[model samples]
Target: MSDIVGELARVAGAFDQPTLTLLYRGHAKVVIAMLRSAFTRDNRTISAARLHAQVDTYLDQLRIDGFTDLPSGSGRDLCLRWMRGQWLVRSVADDGAEVYTLTSHAQDALNLVTNLTRERASLSEHRIATIVNAVRRFNTEVNPDRGARVDILNSEIARLTRERDRLLQGADLTRPSADYMLEGYGELLQLVAALPSDFARVQEAFTALRTQILGSFRAEDRHAGEVIDDYLRRTDSLMTATAEGRAFEGAFTLLRDDELLLQLREDLSALLSHPMAEDILNDVDRRDLRGTVGLIRRGIDAVLAQRNRVTATLREYIQTHNTVRDRELDNTLRQLDAELARWMTSAGPRTTVALPLLPARLDVHHLRERFHNPDDDAGPPPLRDVTTQRPDGLTLADLLAQGGPSLDQLRAAVHEALASDEPLASLGRLFDALDAPLRRPVEIFGLLHLTTNMDDFVRDKEHTEVYRTLRPDGTRRDLAVPVITPGPQSPDSPVTFAEEPRGRAPRLEPA
Candidate 1:
């Protein structure tokens, strides 16, 4: 009786697991359908806002379909409720977007419903063969007696060699029936479907481990080094100690082996192309089979990403952890808690006490140093009478000589030269004909600038032009500039120049 009771209790405990509870709930079908639709092998996560809107749309459609026994509230509220139920997990993704992912329990529930809904043979030659082959392989690897293991391997090799010889001899190939193909495809898909939940388990394990480590860090109950050592040890054992970890390690090995991966792809392609495949499998089945390798790769990437996050968390904590400050804060919090407990014991529910939100200000009487003084603020002694001081006077021509180029005069000279029937051979000839003021060194720059903007000018790279510039002190200096030749202007858009300044040169500087 006790043994039966113990077995019953074990079964009950299994049913109580979140994975089972999810299926046992009132809206199990609706929830499972939603999860399967939202999360797929290729897409494992959805941004929070997108998922909320999707859920709302799903609920709205369900209501329109007359399924009124549905959960109330908006999609966001439903998601939060699902999160509390451990069916949906809300986490910040690597890109810092808040995303929703199906928890391992939720994935398991979905997988179960999928298996149940899909039509599959309960028993088949393919299924039996798979079991037998698995058992034979397991025995060959694990058999304690070396002689037995070697004998098993030899037998397998001999059988395969005989089959290969027969195939090479042009023996007629035996084709599998549609039913057999269907059964095999079903088994393959079932295995493929389970991979997501398996990967999710490993990811959840790492996340839980990280959460525990963070708690330990906050508590400071153990030395940081000891905690880190424990973390490293667990992490190293993680890939070997648990079933999911072992599966991940196997998948990781498969990923590393290029030849094996290629062979897998070839085999899947061959299976998909079989004559029976068309009748046995549908488009969805074909897609799932074709994407098996991609699914495994994604799963491995997700697990590795989760592991990296844990490592980063540990590293960041180690780099920023301040033992002295943490200890001081811990002590202060403990003292505060003790005082609060004592006060609570002596106080009634209605009793109240006035307390300032911040610490009281210091009652300072005086400060010796002053930031400002009235004596220093006195106006400066009446401005010095600089009117009595005589300064040298300057004329407008002196200022213009010291200023920039006379652009108007230079522009008119170039336009006149280009517009004339006998245009100047080079800008140097025009410069020589210009008035003294327009031949200033600065005016040479102005002519070059205007020439660059006109279509009627071409620079002669082989030659140089010298301009005689008159200095403010009445001295002449020859300056060499690049030679520019004026060409004929098109009649359609003739070059127009501003009239030369008629009055004295204008002062360019402020007084």
Candidate 2:
């Protein structure tokens, strides 16, 4: 068994490293000796020719399987083939030729076999002993028939009860509708957003009060009343504000004069005024100091309950969505990673060959024709784009200006470096640091687009005005104002806005 394991290891190693090819070839002689020794107990002499024939037959059989073909000259293959060639009766060579003798190589093989075989047998015995001990202990201690049937029947009954309930509920049961609950959640969110720098401060204070209430049920927590009062006062002040300080009758608004959330509050107020609950709602004052507190508290509780249910539903939805999305993304990423790994392992593309362009040089005006619809319906077939860049005609400065070097170009550079005896590892490291293929900048402006934004200027205190140089000579400057035109529009098109700009100079070009 040890001998077989060693042979399997030697064969597996051959595919892992090219350098180990010749080393395993020398291990054959000992294997053949071990085989001969195993068969030597038979009282018969094995002829060399017959022995060689037997080994050849074994080798033929191995070839039929997936094992690599062994060379006739390889000592290891010779020994293995000879061992398999033997008929039922075993025999040995003496002169290490046909005298049923073992060679020094065969002795070494036997030593390895002895150690491994002993280790394997010891492990097997230990495993069997452990299994037997466990079985005996369990059998002695456990009464398999003791109340098991009752317990099993109870478990089955419970399982069946649950399954029946599930069937009655229907496997495709949907959630309670979002129509009645969304307004409450939205109001809570809006209320949180309307607070000063420490948004949700009142909510946090109330949460602490609730925690304290739970901890000391009977104790007079006077601080809880103070906390709730402070929160109520702040919420009341926010709900009554209006344009030009005119007294308002709503909670809040995101738009002019009337807040959209105030409408939601009114709608909910109406919904809660049903025939069953009208008496409770009617007693509460619409703008009374204490009445607002009760309304806010009730709203907060309703929103909290709705949130808990929605959050659980959202979690289930997200978990199912992510499972499918993650599987697809993982498969795609693996394929991309494999392609990239392969490129790293093998010889990369050569880019020295000059890429000839079409008769007309590509420009922005011709971009649509060159890239999108390059030919008419009956026109000649479009020219296929080539991977190689024109390197010979262009100067180094021009090449550097044209987005540095491509992967193909860099690969060509590596080939050149190799011929000059430069380090390939260092070259590889430089390429590895580069951004991935699609993320790499394909245009000059794309590289520049990443560097600046209006927000950057706004955030910088030093700059009074932000402007862009129109020419390399720096003769002219254009006031940098972001403009978005309504409807489908282009950069060159006139800009328009639904409302007039507030308080700022007309820096943007007029529509």
Candidate 3:
């Protein structure tokens, strides 16, 4: 009982808070009044203009009844509020205006409120057949090894055939009277009422399972493998041992049983068309009778969609848990790839190449256009002068291998410059104090970045040492660069690095 109440509370939190209050007070009639006239009997869609007209009529009637302080009469805002309560769905029309449709949840809620509580139910052939079918389904599905499933099916076929033959022989079989039809519909109505409640219960089960998984995840003592094993165990239990799960399986099987559905459809269609049936069934009862098979199929689809939602959530969590491990695995594979590539390159004539060289440079856009329109540029493209090329054609790896100084060497040289007694030591001063190798733009930028990090050195921004720079096309400019100098270190704090071990991963216990 407590579990059911708890689940109810969870479901209540998911819907509009005002929904239950409004429904309890019969205010659903207000919105439903608009909905009935907003569209035709067969049509589910309502245009904004049509809906406004309905609301206008409703408000005018309210005023005639001497109602006071009513809000502005636009169905648009009212419809939007109902949408928040999951009563309606909206889409944009061709003219960029809104169109509304009644949702399945809203239909179920309205049906439950309007029909199920209106009358008392009693047993009939329909009720008896439903109970027999449900029990048989459970027996075969849950205990298939008991070995009576084939016999049950065979008996059903024989019984149906015997009835057909009796009718063919013109035997005066007792047809259901008016009272019998009403009783049968009462049973059918109860079944349809329970279907939505059944779907809600299944949804609750899925929600509870997700909560359990997430709680286990957030636990400080969680073992990842145990969490996963528990998840699989819960999934199996939900599928095999639960009534809701079995009901879903039954509905799914029914959806694929075209012969059975066709037979049921013909039977119901014939039953509802009887002149006696018309005397008992009102518009509401007729709607229920006409939509019975379709509603069951839709219920089954809802359950399956929930099942898929839970499965997708599990897949997503598994992906999230493995993200770091997958990243590490990728890094290891990339290292292996680099090793293989380097081995291949060293085995050939070129030992200096860092990455594989292309036969020609790639221009992605030009290539795409050329492939699509091969003859568009019939003439050959132009070339540039060879004098534009630089002399330093060696790869960075080749330069490193040939014993040139690295970033650490440059930083150490700058550190020595910062230890001096000058107020501002320019790059020229550093170059004079320590040997600055063939000054390239790369080396200059590297030293400038290194100067930012020295323990007691900072940039003197008010001054700059200008350098004459030459561009690739032979253009020149005077570029201003920062000069570094030693500054007083702060008395209070010093930077320190901490070392901690990566903890052991969680493991699963043996079953």
Candidate 4:
């Protein structure tokens, strides 16, 4: 009776889990389909806006298909609801984009749906063989007796050697039957599909650990060093302590071993190329099989990124945490709480207290004000006329030289050079040939700027050309500029300079 009651309680607890709750909810099929479509093994995360749009589209399609019983609200609202339900996690990516990722519970739910939908024999020769091989290998590795372990290894080696020799000797190859291949493929996919959730579990564990560490810090009961030490110890043990962590470690080890990875790839390729593979797997299945290594790599990256985030959190807290200020704030809050309690005890329920949020303003008998006297308000005397004074004789050319680059003049030069019958080789050559005014140092910037708005200019990064710029004072300076070559320009969009307001420089607008 006790055992039966315990089993019932365990069953109840399992049903209470988020994974089961997701499955038990209304419109589970639609929700699951949406999630599976939105997030995949390769594409684990979707930007919040993109995902919301996708959800809305999916819901629209479902409604069009005559599915009336659906979740109420917009996609964003649904996402928020799902987040609260723990199916979707809203987090900021490293690039600071808000993204939604399926929680491990949601992944488990998806995996369960995938498995249930997939067709495979419940009992198969491949399944039995896999189990037997696993058991044999487990026993061989864990056997306490050295002689027994050696004997087991020797027998396995002998068996493999005989098989290898037979294959090498041109013996007829034993081809896997389609059913056997199908079963194996099914098993492999199931294993592969579980990896995402496993990785998510590890990430969630780290996230939870980080949250706990933060709480401990906020509590201020433990010393920073002790908290750090405890964190270090937990992080060290994490990879070995949990099933997800162990799986992640195994995947990490596999990733680090280049030879092993190469071998795995070769084996997957060989399997994929098998004659039975064509019938056993579809395009999706084949693609998934081919991307096994990539999937593992992505999983490892996500786990490492999560771990790095935790490390960053620890480092940031240690660097920025102000013990003195935090203590002061904590004491202040305690004093406020004590005073509030005393007031509550003495006051009636209906009594009201009016208090100023800020300190009262200072009181003064008099604020000295300056009254406007007639003398003070009197206007200044009339200014002297400067019309009689003669100004220095300056030419328009001199004013142009002292002012900004001659963009309009530079544009005409570039247009004439480009429109010439002879091929205009480069901008530098054109600048060198230009008149003194157009060859000003500032005019070089104007030339480059004009070329940028043109259609056919290509700047050669590898080489540079010198622009011999002439100053107004007759001083010349050669500036090294990137080699800009103009390509064949389109007749329709000719580069033209347009006039602007008086003070503004003319721009090279495309015609």
Residue-wise C-alpha lDDT for candidate 3, range 1-511, written one tens digit per residue = 3699889889878554443544543355666555545533245567766776777778788778997645553666776777776666675655788877665556555555656467645666666777888897787667655457777777778999999999999999787766666777776666666565566556556656766766766563445677678777877776555666777666667677989878878888987887787787788777866876786676566567767777788767855776467568879999999998878965866655466566776766643433457678588778767765856676765565344334666666665555445543466456444442424334455555554554455566566665443333355455566555556655453422112222221121111
Q: Candidate 1 on 179-265: residue-level lDDT in tens?
A: 788888888989989888888999988787778767866766777688678767866776776677787788788687978888999
Provide the lDDT at 77 for model 3.
75
lDDT of 2 by residue, 1-511 (tens): 3699889898887544322222244544433433544433221245656655655666666667766734554433464443443212223333456443332233333334433432122234334555786675565457477586566557668987988899798775434234223333233333332222121232223333434433442243334345346434533443223231122122223223344546656765664553433332233222322233333444344334433433354334333433455568879999998987776776557624355676765566533435445355567779887748545676665545445424344434333433443333331132334334312223212212221221111122222222232232234433333421112224354322222223333232211
RMSD to truth, every model: 22.1, 41.6, 29.0, 18.6
Alpha carbon deviation, residue 92, candidate 2 (Å): 12
Q: Which wins on lDDT, candidate 2 or candidate 3? A: 3
3 or 4: which has the higher lDDT?
Answer: 4
Query: Which sections of candidate 2 miss by over 4 Å?
Result: 1-40, 43-45, 73-100, 118-511
lDDT of 3 at 244: 61
In model 2, how large is the Cα lDDT of residue 60? 64
**Which model is ahead, 3 or 4, in terms of TM-score?**
4
lDDT of each: 0.81, 0.39, 0.62, 0.85
**TM-score sort, best first:** 4, 1, 3, 2
What would the TM-scores of all predictions be? Answer: 0.65, 0.15, 0.41, 0.66
- Candidate 1 lDDT trough over 10 residues, lowest sum: 502-511
Winning candidate number (TM-score)? 4
Count steric clashes of candidate 1: 0
lDDT at residue 237 of model 2 (Cα atoms) = 43
* TM-score preference between candidates 1 and 2, better one: 1
